[model samples]
Target: MKISTFISTLALTLLMLIPFNSNAQEFPDLDKSPMDAAAFPSKYDEPKKLIKIIYSRPQLKGRSIWDLAPVGKVWRTGANEAAELTIYTPMLFGDTKIEPGTYTFFMIPGKQEWTAIISKDLNVWGSYFYNEENDVAKVAVPVKNDKNNSIEAFSIVFQETSKGTDMYLGWGHIRLAIPFHKL
Candidate 1:
């Protein structure tokens, strides 16, 4: 009887541990889409200061709009949710100060310097349908090729600095960086 009880407790503990493992096997039917705010408990509630950007598959993996993207080509810079890029704190891009808000991110990829554009319009596909007049800010950043092709998932991360913050976008063999100061 003791052996059976021990086995039962062990099984229960293993079952409880599954959800916490990031690499745990997931069932095929389980949906991984972003959940609504109410789905999380009150303890998880906190005002999100950071803007969330989501880039999904197909849109991200296929031919990227760089070098091969054609200089004048309009590209849908990111995926669902309008390829949203957020500024958590006030920042200055180039000589322009950008207030904290969400903006639709777009880029004009070039062999030398890439033009990064943020627009007030946040709902749309690739820049195939872009409007230059909608742009709120535009900054030029240089792109450097990496010897080792490292990044598989296209992503951007912001790092804080004494002056302000550095916005880094990593993908393919390139890393594009933009420095901003507090507005």
Candidate 2:
């Protein structure tokens, strides 16, 4: 009886030594620049999607837009990763036609304008590996300053137009609209 009691006590002690929830994992904190997506339809349950963009939203955090994205330089167009633009249907950026596929999006911020670039490169981390030779389409989009409302974080939104859709990029006091006409 004593031997059985000792065995039971030892088993209980061993069980206590082992973690009760060994499967529990330690998750990291939220990212400073969170991933976001903007679709043309905007609706969650929309069946057909004309275009979608996956990007990381980076906040200004009291930083200047010129400092964050310097003029005459290629920016990732977001935070960590270069924005990914998925075109469901063929669209025209200027005279250049972009086919239905996923492409890396980049930008060259300027004082009065910004050049939007859609490259063939995939899985790119940032503009560090951006190659101009892989550019599928490039368009010069005029920048508009919003004096009244200054956006803190980088944001992208789509607005329907009679031609197609306007993809607006807003950050700080700068705003740009790249028109993608249906082709």
Candidate 3:
């Protein structure tokens, strides 16, 4: 109501709108992995690249990862945040047809193999409320495990192929690969 009071309130509100200087004091986890995406050129002879996957990398830290991605379990794919697959064009992701958009990535880990999933749901966390019906595709990824060869962290990457790309997941001495073809 008063002029002085109104000016004081406006000044306070403006200060709050300014960016906080908290970045210096805030500490970050050294163990926290970074988010990365793997993109490849399209097979249609297009100049631009397509088929991108964004995911976080989680280290094993000598802990058993099988507990989270145990046999017959529906895996969230990685840690922290759910993995995301973004395509610039329509393509078959793990045998499931998907249009140009982003998708949630999940998995079903088995002793012999792993099934990668492209889900219609977005921003899912830790496989919570994972619906089989929401999946766009559940394609089997060939798996190979070596006791001597240990992978330190969970990773999602792709290898160039004539048709499209061969997506690979490597973690804890285990590696799985699946195909994604551009239509």
Candidate 4:
């Protein structure tokens, strides 16, 4: 009975979250990062779809996102709802092993490196409810700066490297790549 009750409550909570995420888009006109960016899935012409990251893209409308997303803080990894990463196969994310599943993605930004977290918690609006105990894997990745150019909107793009896929989280003028390979 408890299991059934838990499932029902979980379902309702997810339902309520969608509306709040929409409400997050209702920012003032002068506000930067106004677009509640949501990235859809795109498949590469490979064996099958490998990984999918779902998150919103907030643009840097001439204002520095650094004011909103400072160093040494936990970013929701995107706007609105929490960013989610879905792995289709067994793989290695840095030194951590990740099996096929979906998990909430979070990041703690620092001056030199960023800590990437794959958390068990779901349906979270942002880092507001982030719990370290629920983390499945956490690894530090060095920051990559594109000094010559700046990204207007936050984006997640996959680059097929020689070893595996390099997942890049680009925002403002910063980009961090997390490498993952099939086992």
Which candidate number would show the highest TM-score if scored against the true structure? 2
lDDT of each: 0.63, 0.93, 0.80, 0.78
Q: Give the TM-score of candidate 1.
A: 0.64
- Order of quality (lDDT): 2, 3, 4, 1
Cα lDDT, model 2, residue 123: 91
| Per-residue accuracy of model 3 over 85-137 as CA lDDT, tens digit each | 77787887655678888889888898788888888889887787788898888
Put the candidates in TM-score order, highest first.
Answer: 2, 3, 4, 1
**lDDT score, candidate 4, position 55:** 79
The TM-scores, one per candidate, come to 0.64, 0.93, 0.77, 0.74
The sequence of per-residue lDDT tens digits that candidate 2 reaches over residues 69-161 is: 999999999999999999988889899989999999999999989999999999999899999999998999899998999998899999999
Off by over 4 Å in 1: 1-52, 57-68
Would you list the clashing residue pairs of candidate 2?
none
lDDT of 1 by residue, 1-183 (tens): 699999999999999977776768866762232212110112233363433344432223456545434675554453334466666667677877778887777777777878888788876766667889998888889988886875755556666677766767776777888777765
Q: Pick the candidate with the highest lDDT.
A: 2
Clashes of each: 3, 0, 1, 2
Native RMSD of candidate 3 (Å): 6.6
What's the CA RMSD for each of the models? 11.0, 1.8, 6.6, 14.4
